[model samples]
Target: MVYAPIHESLPGPISPSDRIESIDALRGVALLGVLAINLVTEFRVSIFQHFLPAALPASSLDRAVETVLMLAVDMKAFALFSLLFGVGLAIQFEHLAANSRRALLLFRRLLVLLIFGLIHLCLIWNGDILTAYAIAGLVVLPFLFGPRWLLLAGAAAFLGLYLTMQVWSPPGLFPSLASIQSNVEEANRVYATGNFGEVLAFRLREIALILPLHIYVFPRTLGLFLLGAFVWRSGVLQKPNHVLLFTAGAGCVGLGAAMILLRAGNAMAGTSFGVLATPAGTILLALGYGAIIIAIASSARGNALLGWAAPLGRMAFTNYLAQSVIFGWIFYGYGLGLFGHLGAAEALAIGLVVYVAQVIFSGWWLGRHRYGPVEWLWRTLMYGTPQPLLRAGLNDSGQRAA
Candidate 1:
């Protein structure tokens, strides 16, 4: 079923010179979408409120915006990010010479990421995906060496478990308006007025809430990772073609549309159907988005425009942390204390503005440096040695010695 050139006979791992620009562009795009959804949380709004009618009253425009975002952005963005992480692991595994070496490196990488996630959750923000990705990375490690069918089966099993839980789980336990309002009020009070210690305590409580959902979220994340690995093993991304890209893009969009229609009659905010369909639709849409971005990046003019994202993508680790730091200052008590004051539309606008600025800053930094500051640190820590940071004479991929 693979539609690209096979790399079975390749001599060694793909060099940095062989980096995929489309993947980078897609990651950059996913980052923006992630920020879109995260803005709601950062603004101290209860995302559960979107599902519960009795929570804080939102403006009609806010509800409309939330609906649009739920349909298009929410889970889809994170799914894309998860897929990319798997693709990265696959690429790294391909490049390494030995399984032991690969495992060691990956373990180190994931461990570092876990630490970063903890820091982010405890100090910067409670919603950190890096920790989840790290956990999922561990969950997916066993399948990396297995056949493609085995990986697919594992993904299917995980997804099936999630669906089953959603179908049979009691909907009554879903967040009530009273509960949602209480949490929102507490979050606003702590985040907008509390000291650092108080903020940390509030974040820990939020993380505690997230822990129970890992039963579903972890498996979903692992499944997407395996799917990404499958894509890489199939050699689809390596040999991007117009026909394949179009078909993938169209098929995913079609599937997502169908799923959305299935749940159209129900209020999607907190219903079981919403739980199942939302992720399913978003997963399909995210695939379609990846395909479309690949198509665009394969073209000349489109590639030129999308290339802006490559630098941003390359520095994604740095930019992601930067976002937490910057947004924390803007919205939290220690800084501007603007929490609970902004609407969906206003928060989204701010996210876009910040993203654009990150893109520009990423480009400027990459032009002078081999890697983003945090990326350099990450590599250094993973390898237990100093990694080059300057790019005096290095090439675009920054793999060449300066």
Candidate 2:
């Protein structure tokens, strides 16, 4: 099946329209990848140090499993998600431009995203990227009308400055040794002895202060977004031929393998190159993911996996929130209290279980319902009208009356 942006292009071709199949498929794959990487972070466990590596020890068997997962699933998924977010912005901008209402509409959307992000951060988790993305998006807005070369140069400059900051620091920006130790000690205390409120409070303080990382990290995200826009313009998603699909698969495998090797080296040498390398690797792997999706779309093949994946992609915001809720129950003191207790492999196993359940649940829910719950709510807020929740032959906006 073909995928298109939710909103139609105004000035662009009206016949075929923009079918962004590659993005949908990529999004589905990325959602799963998100669970792969985020489960550890959300549970407050170090996937490498405390989970996978510790769980494995000297066993070649465990090492084998760890190697496969690290290469195939870790770190890359979130980058893909971020890139897609930028693509969504580009699509929205395209529509706004078509209607000559970009300034107000875009600002409204970003404000809403920031509000949603704040709620998620304060109530659910401190690692929310929504506000950061909204803020960065605003910074990138003026440059959106610039030429491709300028955009590329700007992205590169931003990335270079960010890398420099990582290795060296301005005075007073670096945390004091006492402060660093206190933060680490506090984290350990929360994990070891504190309750949910204490853990939330500790993390909230750190998150509130890390604005620079969000700003400087812009180059890569903006770069990827531009790449996505280029791809959208180039008809890659529409074509989905063997060459594109094959290239993507190979790319995913190659970059994914390299990242795994780098991670292993980082572990051996007590280095952090892996963290720095992850974004680039994620970009490559996202391409690979795109290829995989294109292959599925082009072949006209259907599977339970894709069927399930489609629903999650269709209702990504809801599913994202659902992940937090489900994982919170699995890991937090409010539920099973398995935080810091589960290893990476076991965590992945549980994630898979939850994924399967979500797939069935989402598929069933969509079959009978009009939109995923949150999607309906977001649309209602956007249009300032109460949208119907059930299907009744109305427009896609759910405005048809009984």
Candidate 3:
């Protein structure tokens, strides 16, 4: 879901110490969660629906695991990631004082994102989020300069809109097939026999529909963005001493999880109330996520676990792309041809394996390199200069010191 291009150079000071490990760690966690959900997508339907079935064995244990993942990661990651994007935007604007130049910078960034998104959609997969994000980010650009209250108000409206849209969304958004054999046969053709052009056409069609109907995602994103801004403005992210923050987060996690559990049985119905409840639950879950990060940052201060997650967060874009590549290989006809073969439980197992590998790989790679491979490329493109890619131990550029 990473979009936008790097400017030849971003103006203003890029501070070394401005980094916050807590936020980075939380981002790392969110990235893994996103992967968990995406794994299911790659293994299941062309659209985000329940139209497909698991090719793997379906045991009660597996079903329970699938249910949990659907609850925790499916709706949660987008909210968390969107909030982070908003926070990042606020930070970026603060770095460069509001001006036509800043607007130009953001526009260029969006353009780059659009280009990358198109590539991802056409070549990698049709169910790309970068394109949607680029569109939404552009939609809210004018409001970026608006007052905090206005931003919050915009977010509230979007949240309501998203809730309403969920009401109408199809169960699992996948078409119900008359038989498993027919569905699998069709999926095989798309994944195995179909060419990129056909995939693009199908994808673009979905994107067109999603744009108007998914307007709600923007408001939800905006609201989280405003919340992040408020936190940043209030110094909560940096300070980490707000007891109320922890309390609110705990309340959100506790209450939100319970509410989700309560409503989950109805999730497959595509009913109005289910959609509203899911987003509502997601908001509370996001609060809990933020609070936990703040609390951990406060206590850990400079612990090793946070340090480990920090590198993953720093190279999140690289990691996210890597995930798409890996999942495609695993589930697409190009690899094991496991598409539509794994059950939800099996998909979760595969997701866990992928997540573990990424954590280890990210930790090890960061130890020797200045940046994750893609991150280095992005930075070089953004700065229009070659950036150091390897650490020089002590007294080096310190980019890899994390």
Candidate 4:
């Protein structure tokens, strides 16, 4: 059987009209969390070393900060983003009558995203998720029409394989102290003083490092995508299904507590179980976060405050790229040459300030425009035609106007 139209099967919250505000608010939250966790990489700090305080001789305050980040922000944000990506795909599918046309459109959209991602990776930042998402999107497209049971099974199987790899891998696989230090030094040297070519070379090396980990990461991402599609198809996000909401919220709290316990024990034992536990915990937490955000946005009082995030979410593509450009300028040699100078706390503070500015700017821009500049460009390329960037009036069809 073909996938049913979302509007028919889940006609409440997932309705096109009301969907944008809540989803955008949740996305905005995820963006902030991603920025917070990305500070370690931006500062050229070894994440492993930061977590294992003995490796780096971190201060108590630093360790405390890292603990908070690890337990809260790290994997959860990306999971939220991935889930949202799947929801978006399902939403698109709901509007298309012909599967062939839908597939073609999705392929073009992903192709445009891939091009943007490659540009960002090569010239801007190496920690690009867009490329990976685009790649995963292509893989996930065929499965969109699969039954919910099949999707759930696929998610479970892939997640199981990822966890098995994490648990079965020998501790000796961990990078040596010398290797970590050398890599850190090399990254700092290249990013702090290198020319454009040198920076590109370093980025290539970084991409190489990502290649090996994709074995686990790619499958995990696919699993999350399938799970997200399943969630959307099930109508949980479309309506106030208290049973699903309670289940997800309970799962999040339970998994979060378990993650904290695992981390504490790992810290004491000088081992890392986060590779396996963090993903599971974060997935649950991401679902819970999405459900809670939708619930809040549905309310009048909550909307007054959280509605601000919708604008940021609408411009997520633009803000995502802007973060890389602005942060690159702040840290890279070609700009401010401040690489490795700021500590985690300082970097986090700066990221927050930048995000706030983006919120204000995005709201102002969307007030007069149909889409963010980059988003407009992406849609133009995807659709093979120019789109209207200007909002005509309060009756404009774009969600920003609504």
At residue 264, candidate 1 shows an lDDT of: 65
State the TM-score for model 4: 0.86
Evaluate all candidate structures by whole-model CA lDDT and list the values in order. 0.77, 0.62, 0.67, 0.73
Better of 3 and 4 by lDDT: 4
Off by over 4 Å in 1: 1-16, 54-60, 98-100, 170-181, 267-275, 393-402
When superposed on Cα atoms, how far off is each prediction in RMSD? 5.8, 5.6, 6.0, 5.9
Q: Write the per-residue lDDT of candidate 3 for residues 198-267, one digit (tens) a residue.
A: 5445445555434443444655766676666555655677667657768888899888787687677764
Best TM-score among the predictions, by candidate number: 1
Q: Sort the predicted structures by lDDT, highest score first.
A: 1, 4, 3, 2
Candidate 3 lDDT (Cα, 0 to 1): 0.67
Clashes of 2: 1
Ranking by TM-score: 1, 4, 3, 2
lDDT of 4 by residue, 239-291 (tens): 65555676767777677658756765775244446655655666677777777
The top-ranked prediction according to lDDT is 1
Report the number of clashing residue pairs per model: 1, 1, 8, 0
Q: Which 10-residue window of candidate 4 scores lowest in summed lDDT? A: 6-15
Model 2 C-alpha lDDT per residue in residues 253-278, reported as the tens digit of each score: 58766765675567523445655555
TM-score of 1: 0.88
Better of 1 and 4 by lDDT: 1
